[model samples]
Target: MARTPFDAGAEFDRQVRVLTDLGYPELSGLGPERFGALVAPLRARAMAAQESRYEPGAGAGDEGRVPFLLVVSRNVAPIEETMPRTVLHGGRLPGFVDRTFEPGSLERFVATEETLLPDPDAYLLFDIERGEEFCGVVPRDAMKAIAGRDRTLLTIEEGIALVTHFPQVLVKNKCFSLGGSRCGDRRVPAIWISQKAPKLGWCWEGNPHTWLGMASAGTRTGGVA
Candidate 1:
């Protein structure tokens, strides 16, 4: 039998139905949703940045030459020398970034040197490296938690996890809070790096950085980007 061609539109509708049946709130939430508006621009920006770094017939080792963009508000201060170097990009960053990383102390989760920005209210972060592009936005509260060494919001591992698998972590939490059981007993949900979730492409959850009181691994004293 001939295989049916994959219809992106139809596949998208199916995913929508799955999340909708699970009582996804933003789908029925009120007010003009501005966060959802950032998806296209973010993806485009990520792709463009990646394309600019591409070299024809370059070997795999050349991948390291491609830099990741860590766009943020101009008002945001530069990362201090005392603090570990990490962009800590958050929000709906898609999973395609895994350039180079290693486990470290609580103070250094998803650590990467960031290129600061002057754009105000800049939330999305594009982890463009080679062909992978991940969407992310750092929550102000989480930043505060790291600064204040607040143990209540998130732990080092959780914080790292947040940076690693953003909107999914947010969505997974919401699902359980509303009695939805996609993640079973896990509150934040486990998203292994090797196993990528199907790209929903469209934004279903709002700014993940806006959510509050989320911590990982019982909290430890530290600060991050």
Candidate 2:
């Protein structure tokens, strides 16, 4: 049987409605500026993570560079519920896996990352290295007990929407050198967001601490940028 065609815009709108129910007014209009505001912090954190991963005296540059954003989204359905039909490069693929997580050790490596299972059913991992991102959908009934209860700073819908929208802008802007060899290509800075706590928490775990130390060093030497 032929599969029904999926509409990206329509799907986005449906998710926007869900966001409305969750009290995200900004996403309704979802203008470039509004989208940028939501994405700025994530981008900053990704950059910081990259810097931290490479710290001072950690070689001149580009020793082990993995620059890319890992973006995850959660939903109240199976992983396929929100999986995008479009490819990372905006083309069709033979299968969903091809468009989502790259096949190989990279996928296995990503699965090993400390995963937090919060209420609601969705999570995403953005890979700055491969210049690709992956999405995971949690079972809808998985969070029935905590559905209305506010367990975290941001609701499930809000978190997913934020992660989802940000990458679109990043890709559109051509912020990172996605696919190539040199350090630039390998150097993909990434930010991983998931609902692990009561409030939105950001960390620079994957990258080295020296990069963050440098930022602090700069502040002491001068002032924040």
Candidate 3:
């Protein structure tokens, strides 16, 4: 599981580019330059980690190899607006919310109590796992399993950020759930490959899907965002 360390400064710049390409600036109404400024603290943090001789993704366990997930709050970049910009197949297919998910339907699916939003707009998340090993496990049980590992689930917005920055992670048969956000109902939000593209949808909490594993992260931290 060992690998060459990355240049954190370069990676942060790349992520800024990806966000610009994905229309985060416009979506959040910060425009490009302002949006970049808003997230500057994250860049500094990553660079500081490097100065300390610590690779951004380097930590104690195999899962620590997973780099930080930069998430913009749904409050800032509404999923209703951002989901459509999420593309697959080299931008050929744009993502969609399942028709069953009407406008405002996602509003109720707030982040769980265990989840932390270190910033009003954006923050950094560490130790993310797609939870592929939890495939076929009922989501309610999967939540327990993730907690047993001292992890919390990814929220719908966080899921989108991960897929937006790393689209290759959403391949067929490996999609994941966003159990961190819920509506007090039995539903669990998830993004999956649909019509050869990404689709934001939901699943019954008590049901198990052979293709769906709950995604999670270790914790969150505040940043310039």
Candidate 4:
């Protein structure tokens, strides 16, 4: 399949905005020169990490649910596709899933048996501690159920809704709270969705860059956080 080229500059700006929105004030102080010098390379690496040949719903037809595991422990049996987990840190505001996830650079999940799992188009993200409570979500009709919803189906708000559907999980993104007060890591929310949901796939609109910078902590050059 033909692919779209990665846009580093645009991604850099998007990440910069993501950082600023996450309450890192230092990014606002950096000139373009400094940011390009330090942060751009990191962004490039992130872009590289997310590179994959997978296309959304490529092989996914209206079929059985994609097996998903809500793994909270760093040490867990490897699943087929390693869902990228993101931390909603102690002092951050969560508006959308993209905003919350844009900072969690990629993690190291090794798959011991690649033959046993589905060639998943995307991975679901969950924090180590917060995700422990979840067993997994098996959609009644994985593809049909998700495809019916609006585009907002993949946002953090909706993602939380899906998680809270399971018993014993109560969560609210800070953006919806009264004062937007900081919540400790324990209170941080985790998003668990069916592995079959095409909306959550790592490949976005024919480009695999969606998850590239998903985990970077921003550039470290010149003390410009």
Tens digits of lDDT, candidate 3, 51-170 = 754554453224313466667887678888888878764657889889887667788889878886788688877667778887899999999988898887899888888787777677
lDDT of 4 by residue, 1-225 (tens): 744544433434554454334332332344445533433434443334335422333221012111111111122211111122222323122222323323332132122231121212112221111211112222212212333431111222223222222212212311111000112221222232222221122222112121111110111111112
Query: Which candidate should be chosen as best, given lDDT against the real structure?
Result: 3
Q: Where does model 2 exceed 4 Å of error?
A: 1-29, 55-66, 75-82, 88-114, 117-225
**What is the per-residue lDDT of model 2 for residues 23-122, given as tens digits with 9 covering 90 to 100?**
3334224554553343333434434444544333321102112222222233232223322222222323211212223343221221111123221222
Q: Model 3 Cα displacement at 28 (Å)? A: 1.6
The lDDT of each candidate is 0.26, 0.25, 0.80, 0.24
Instruction: After the best TM-score superposition of candidate 4, give how far the Cα of residue 124 lies from its true spot, in angstroms.
Output: 17
The local distance difference test score of model 4 is 0.24
- State which candidate, 1 or 3, has the greater TM-score: 3
Better structure of 1 and 2 per lDDT: 1
lDDT (Cα) of model 2? 0.25
Better of 1 and 3 by lDDT: 3
**CA RMSD of each candidate after superposition:** 17.7, 18.9, 3.3, 17.1
lDDT of 1 by residue, 1-225 (tens): 544433323322343243233332232342123323422244344344345543433322122121222222212222121012222224322343232322222123222122122233223322211111112323333334433542122222222223332233333212111101012211222122222321111112223422222222221111122
C-alpha-based local distance difference test score of model 1: 0.26
Candidate 4, run of 10 with poorest lDDT: 173-182
